[model samples]
Target chain A: MRNLDEDTITQAVLARHTGAPDARLREIMTSLVQHLHAFARDVRLTEAEWFEGIRFLTEVGHMTDDKRQEFILLSDTLGLSMLVTALNNRKPPECTESTVFGPFHVEGSPEYPLGADVANGARGEPCYVRGRVLSRDGSPVPGAELQVWQADADGFYDVQYKGEHGHRARGTLHADAEGRFHFKSIRAEAYPIPHDGPVGRMLDALGRHPWRPAHLHFMITAPGFERLITHVFRNGDQYLDSDAVFGVRRSLIADWVVHPPGPTPDGGRSEQPFYTLDFDFVLNPLAQD
Target chain B: MRNLDEDTITQAVLARHTGAPDARLREIMTSLVQHLHAFARDVRLTEAEWFEGIRFLTEVGHMTDDKRQEFILLSDTLGLSMLVTALNNRKPPECTESTVFGPFHVEGSPEYPLGADVANGARGEPCYVRGRVLSRDGSPVPGAELQVWQADADGFYDVQYKGEHGHRARGTLHADAEGRFHFKSIRAEAYPIPHDGPVGRMLDALGRHPWRPAHLHFMITAPGFERLITHVFRNGDQYLDSDAVFGVRRSLIADWVVHPPGPTPDGGRSEQPFYTLDFDFVLNPLAQD
Candidate 1:
């Protein structure tokens, strides 16, 4: 057998998989094959180098656990997660921009009524997030379910604190009859992804920094319509362009403006520092049931 | 913002990635994106479902250890390692055929002199392996370093056993001035990869079998030449066509016919069969360097 270069084998592997008839799948596989091969060829990978790569991935696997996802972190740092997220979601103008799931969501959040505070009195810049669910033609789709979850002001998810449950700023709410939803919550702040794992080692090797922009996570679902898991990003965060996971998008960016509000005691909770965002969502409906 | 189905989000992720200009890279990425996206679509992935995938991968990470690489096993079983190995090494005919490094190589291996059996005292049918290292022009390549390794008759490596110094089946030896090298070793046995980890779970999920054909590992290097890391797969192993990792190349298969030493007491423990095969390795000098 003739010796094949790195690119040739990649091409062959990719070749056997083409013509899947699912045009979307075809396009994606093609890109993945190309980039992966190029990355290998760019370095002129040696046998040892190749094995080393395999070994690195093996280590990545070993670093994963129930509480942490080093592989997800790896995909995040590599921008693969973001790249896939973006390629799949293209909203019509003026919709809430999508972001990565960020590997923190736990199922069956407590459902709250409309206008309730999801932040549960946590301290941070106060902001009101208001949005409406609508069909692609801009028709309001009332009574849709919205699940909102986010890391706390300290950048640690509720799950990370171990036994600290009892509502760590996560909840679900239904869109009102008018298709509008609102909630009072603290503004999202920039955070660092977990770095004490093998993913961190990989980042060190690649010379990449780990910082994500401030953002809010939302999952909305309507009967006879597709569910959307997306985000509204605070535009001014320093790590917007290169969110450790590359999750930022122009349409998703929201204004984190200073909006002072009158407040009583409780350490002047909202008296001075405050932020407000007026964001909306656009959704495509499932074709007639 | 509105909820989008997993397919839509997957597409959106790809859209955000700017296209690569390199033609080869572009071709491959296009396919990779397609396959990855298809996998996502095939499962009708959900935010939670995708998270579980991340979790599965995290467990894969958690399974890695210094002595064992679960991800390499994952890649090997999924046919990625071999595919990548084949795509990169484009050697001309008559050179040694390259194959994957079975995930057992430690950074340091013992060194031995020429004609020494790497398989020292391992109990099995005796086999004699001889090879010549030559350049493409048929010139003998003296001082060629041949670092050879193979699994035991029971299909477990010495490292896996943790007590043996490994049979003379593995060592680094320098070729003689005439380009000749010889070693004695027990015949290899087809082995099953580790099936207790996440990779094993993946194989179960994919409904694929796991079994690698018997083979001896070799790494041949000569100054100013392309190095070769390859395997000589046993010709009649049932797993040859379906080498769990897809590492079988028809050209690399070798027949080890039984040799009769006229009523030997060793095989005279004679229920065991034996064979001798004289294999040759020819490496090409790097054309540029």
Candidate 2:
């Protein structure tokens, strides 16, 4: 038994468990020990510095609320978020590119019919998004549950409105027997990342940007195939090359063509204006661990 | 000018600004935008994950207090602590190696006179550490301030035992005109990184060990040189190969050789069993930021 000091404290604590028989856990712990110890030694840590590091982490935990998660944000800002996502989304092609399932998906979004309006009262460049969900073999996946969430025309989420409204342009829709789904909404705009927290402070200290490109999020699932979480980026957004969260993919970019104020398929007020958004999604089989 | 949705709410709230930007603020914002955007792109983040990340970060903030900082712990556990220390401590040879401060060391530690016993009531191997804090030129820097804090015999920092007794094995010690400093305490012991937080959970998930090797933390400063935050590792700790925070350096290891516990021939308690712990610290001048 070693007495309390800097290194001894770390040793006693880390000694509680040896490498797990499980190879994955063993690898992670091994790498973690090397990196963490190297970090401590590199700085020649002090008691005050150690405590300061603890206090910073404590603040990260306390800053959390129903709407925010500083630790996850910290991880995201530090490249861990993408690393985890990339690590997990390794299915074969023809499967829709799996992206991160962000935290703001409302359990109960206003459900719309097969072709009902998803952007009830929003204003922007109106676009008709039509899509089909299919298995990797190209068979239409009917009755597939699809959750489509996007920012308003102005690039903000409904949750940001708090008391004003909830889940705007965000809701659940189901594909018909043909696996065809269509809805009307406005194009999303690029937005910045959170910068008022410690992640932000660290970023500020190091000098970095936080802009994400425009995109619409979708989560589609069927019983046999895997739950597909993905997004379609606007083809030519200025920040496409430098998305804040790195969600862009070659296949996910859509062809959003402006069609002027043409006649709606149903022949409503034609001159109001609208755009056409078309894309498809392919899902892989589900693998539960 | 866009409306908020769940997807964009994080950015909107994070970028909520105070209008005009000064030079420093602009510089901060500019760099923040780049790195953050790159991080997002580097990982290809999505909406659900983005909100979840926000929520995680919010909790980190909620966990902060004067006694602890979860954010720093997150940074320490994540290797950011050592990264910052390394980037900050590019000193020439002979300077003490800087390291991450752990999660303790509160204010109000009683100041002790030179040659006074700092071991309090804890019992273990006795060691007398004598050091001269000098500049790079080898000249003794008179009137330098030194703050000494260490763990107890049980591999726990004095602050960890809060409510049992206050400021045990932690306090400030100043150097005499010769840049000389001495104190009597038991040789420090090995301990663990705090394992009761999200950091612990991360380690568990990663199958990582939290043990750091044994070492003593030191923060030495004088009028001209940079404030030196460093450590002296116990030579034989088995965990040196894998420091939890990556803080170990080849030069930082020290051997507090075991000898019959005895007082110094300088007319102190020659009867008490004690070991000799001696070292010298040289500091680089603080660089202008």
Candidate 3:
């Protein structure tokens, strides 16, 4: 404890932390310190670089307020969010895989009935999204509650807007008696994440783009089933192969079929081109306690 | 790249970063990703735990401002700062060792002539600190500039005060022709770091104290020598064995000799008890570029 050098310092830190009352906290912090120290040693980090990291982190913190979360964005961009998602959501092979739950998901979104216009004046091409909630055995899981949200064509969520912008392109709905759900919303479009902050600067310096593929976020919950937080990415997005957040999955990708001005899924007439998407979600049973 | 699992996501992220133009940035990022992913996998970090960590980091960031750097404090408490210091500053067997450059050192401290009262009305027992600057071979390195600072008896730096509290217990002075220097300042005392923030809460949760051993910080510099950032710790401080920041080194400890009310080191009379500490600093030559 008195004369800690580079190699012995890690053990000293772990020794100091052995008194943590919470076993889980102790374990987590132990691994965290070991890996963090190893990272610094492996890089032979200089004082200037260390100070730069400190400055970067402080700026990230200062940039964070009630509306934006720069820390989450940093984690997402680093692929940590995806890794955590993968570790926590190990599901059956047939079930829908989960991805990074982007920072845009909000609680108490305006509730809409099946097939209603959940987009509610958001800017994008008209789209009809149809989906069914099913169990791993392919049987319907009726009345499963679905929380859906997505960015507008301009790549901004309702919260991202500075002023009072009513909720758009996001809402809550429930599957029908047959576990089928549909909603009229905007078509998903590729867009860059908020890149005007420190994280954006980091991405630029790293020669990496901040664009996430077009995707619709979904969070579904039902009785006797595990909660699902995932996204339905559009098939032909150029950024699909290099999603900034590493949130794209092959199973989550589906086609947004283009249609000429014609009858919609709800039997409504359309003068302009629109789109339709049909995808099914399979829920895993909750683990037995 | 699109279907990354927990283990594979690390490689995908590293691969995406391969386009970074800077070789140093590429190397640092590669190691960072590897260690970061290993930590998550080692802990099997869950979604809830990951979210908690994000929130904790956000709080740490929010707590930081122009004067307070919670991130640096976090690094210090976790021993990362010391590890970085040790890694960057590898002195010879006899040269003085470097330690954590605490967050409180401010630039532009009022300069003082030798034997001047640098405390400037700060509260603590009067102490005369005499020290010399020498090379590893024990030859004097005259006129070495020393920047010194320490906390008052209340365990608060001048910057910690909310209002206009002038600089106290800190100043800059230069060694004389014989590499000898002495200044009037306050005796160091064990004190808790700024603990009203998230880091404090974390320390409490880990069943650890927030107190650092009594010590005075010093940064010495001269031509043709490496800059040295170190501390002169009191020999018998209770917290020395378990400093909250892991900043204590055996060689840095020195005796603070107590004296009765009598003539002081500056040939001045003192009606109250005082202390004296004599220390020597050895600097290493600058590394060849």
Candidate 2 per-residue lDDT, tens place, A30-149, comes to: 444444554455445544555555565656666566776666666655444554555556678677776655555678788888777777666467777888988878989998998888
- Provide the TM-score for each candidate, comma-separated: 0.74, 0.66, 0.98
Winner on TM-score between 1 and 2 is: 1
Where does candidate 1 chain B have its weakest 10-residue lDDT segment?
B1-10
**lDDT by residue for model 3 over A266-286, one digit each (tens)?**
988999999999999999999
Evaluate model 3: give its lDDT: 0.94
Give chain B TM-scores in order.
0.83, 0.82, 0.98
Please compute DockQ, using alpha carbons, for every candidate against the native two-chain complex: 0.21, 0.13, 0.88
The CAPRI quality class of candidate 2 comes to incorrect
Give lDDT tens digits, candidate 2, residues B1-289: 1222224423432453223244444443333433454444444555455555555555555655666566667676655566556655666766666776666655556788878777787656677788898887898888787777777667888666657665666667889999998887778777778767666666676567778788788777677688877777888888876677667777777888776545563456655556667878888877777
Question: Residue A176 in candidate 1 has what lDDT?
Answer: 90
Instruction: Highest lDDT: give the candidate number.
Output: 3
Per-residue CA lDDT of model 3 for B169-217, tens digit only, reads 9999999999999999999999998899999999999999999999999
DockQ for candidate 2: 0.13
The numbered model that scores best in DockQ is 3
lDDT of 1 by residue, A1-289 (tens): 1233443455554554444555544554455445555544554444565676666666676666677677788777655575456555655555555667778877898899977778885657667777788877778989999998877789876778867656767899999988999887787988889887777765554445667788888888888876688778887788776566767667678786675566622234564666667777887665573
Q: Between candidates 1 and 3, which one is better according to lDDT?
A: 3
